[model samples]
Target: MSPRRILFIQTQGENAGAQEISRLVGAGLGARGYDVSHLFFYRKSPSFDAPPNTRYCSHDRPRGVLGALKFPMQLLREIRAIRPDAILTFQHYGNTVGGIAARLASSAPVIANQVSARMLMNPLVRTVDLALGMFGVFDLITVNSSDMLMDYARYPNNYSKRLRYIPHGFDLKTTDLTKQQARAAFGLPPDVPLLGSVARLNAGKRLDAAIGTLADSPDWHLVLAGQGPHEAALRQLVVEKHLETRVYFTGELPPERIGDFLAALDVFVFPSRAETFGLAAVEAASAGVPVVASDLPVLREVLASDGQPAALFVDAADRCQFTDAISRVLNDASLRADLIAAGRGLHARYSVARMVDEYEQLLRDLLAPVPQLAPQS
Candidate 1:
């Protein structure tokens, strides 16, 4: 049989979490002898890695409600032309616009990914998602965590049948760099304790809480690697809190260099108000760095344990609690070692190979011919 043609759609062509998933999944499918192509709704920056076959429609995003309504039609034309065996969309815009496009374009199965636990917090988004679900725009909804699936189960539909739980897995490969080498590359001093996070400087991430924790401990330095619209606000917060010297922003590092950044950190901090999978935390753990993160349900599901937790959990808004957790991890050598070991355990469970295998098998099953019932039955 010929290889199935799969199209992966993403809202943006950036190195954000969703885009990374799209790239990895597409690459995985391609390696499995499937034909893969990538589509991006917007291509503001050339940050995303467009493996072999990629297309950028450059759809103009108009302003406000009218623009939002018009977006799906734009996708409808493109999807109609490049009709593939199936379509997989990542994140909200892809799930909503690209999903509807896929349904209108062809009878191919449309797989929608839900990456945020709190995406429905917005009234408009919630209404849109529910409407799409009722219209059968999505054939299957893939969530990175069970906690996120539960969040969606509150609606009226029999979502249990359509929803699939697939954990976000990491590429276990590492860059050939030691902690000392990574820190030296960035001109960071050898002895200063470093606390780092790789996240977009957005309000939902609550990077201010991480900066606020810096005030509690002058001995440690905070390094943030990522860029977004909230950079100015976060910079002003750093100025207001007098954390200019202690806090450093590295803009957005390329995906390839993220491992180096993780290696340079003495401890990794994830203080997001909400998270669906906590990918960065898992990546930090994979790099053998101790993590202290917000006590969100998704974080607890991925990292915390009754036996030995992979990360130290703290209240999202409590800077004091974050500071306390960081202090304990930094002060105790034994605790650091234990956290690293726990992190390795998590890395083993969430391997990229396993994720790829599951995705491939699911796609095959979806494409398989349905069994016929016996005449007697």
Candidate 2:
């Protein structure tokens, strides 16, 4: 049997959580004897190498009327040349483009993977809305959580069909580094209780609440990683709140240090206002660290819905609740231990291998004699 050609598309150069998920899934597929190709929104030329039968297509367009007009034409042309058997796209912008381009190129199936619930909540522009409507015409729609799928289905009158929830991929079998080893590697004190939060430095992340919660507890050291537009505001808050000692700003650590950082932390706090699937929290869980996250729809879907609310839950924007949750998780060793155990069990289901296998099954199922669509009427 010949390997099927799959095209994965993303319309950005920045490395966000969604892009990382796509890369992991794509890499997994490529390794498993599938012809997986990734298309970039801004690649000027094939500058780097990809896996066998995998390559990037340049889909750059300058920002203007000319660029806007030329984008669709260029996308159509690229799709025709690639001639992929199936198409997969990440992020809302890429999904819109891929949906339209795939239809124009051929009747082959397309997969629009929604990794961002933030984008799904807002009222999409008419153009993007039309593009999403095109998504209904595709073979399948994938979301990281049921909340995200519901977001897509919110406007049923305007929208077309149901979407499937395919959680973000992770390697649960990753090497588990000991707290002592991780601390030594990062050169941290062995005894101090460390609290960590990893996410984009944006207003919606609500890390200020975490700082406020930890301000009085000098012994409860906190580390805020990831850079974004809200850095100045967060830094100002740290000084204003007199939490300069309790809270440390490490900026954004590279991808390599993710496991190390998670390992060093005694507990993980995610105070984001919105998270389709908290990959950081999941990683912390896989590392056997207790997590404290916001009590939101998606957070519950990711953590609580599975009957494992042992991980402390608090309002994302509530400093009081955030502080209470963190304190409860940190001060009470028994509670933390239970939470970590439950988290590990829950994390087992989210491994990257399982994620890739699900996608492979979905693709194969979609290519079956009568392709099943989203399991909806």
lDDT by candidate, in order shown: 0.80, 0.72
Q: Give lDDT tens digits, candidate 1, residues 1-377.
A: 56788988877776678877778888888998988988877664555555678776663434588776665666676777677888898878777767777887878888888886655346676667667776677778888887888987776674446788888877753678998998887767677899999997788998888888778688889889888878999999888988787788887777888988888899999999888998888888867899999988888888843456898888959877889999999999999999998887877778778888878877877786546667895
Model 1, residue 82: C-alpha shift (Å)? 1.9
Candidate number achieving the greatest lDDT relative to the actual structure: 1
Model 2 worst lDDT run, 10 consecutive residues: 44-53
After superposing candidate 1, which stretches have Cα over 4 Å from the reference?
59-74, 119-121, 304-307, 368-377
- Kindly provide the TM-score of model 1 when superposed on the true structure, using C-alpha atoms: 0.91
lDDT of 2 at 362: 81
Give the C-alpha lDDT of model 2: 0.72
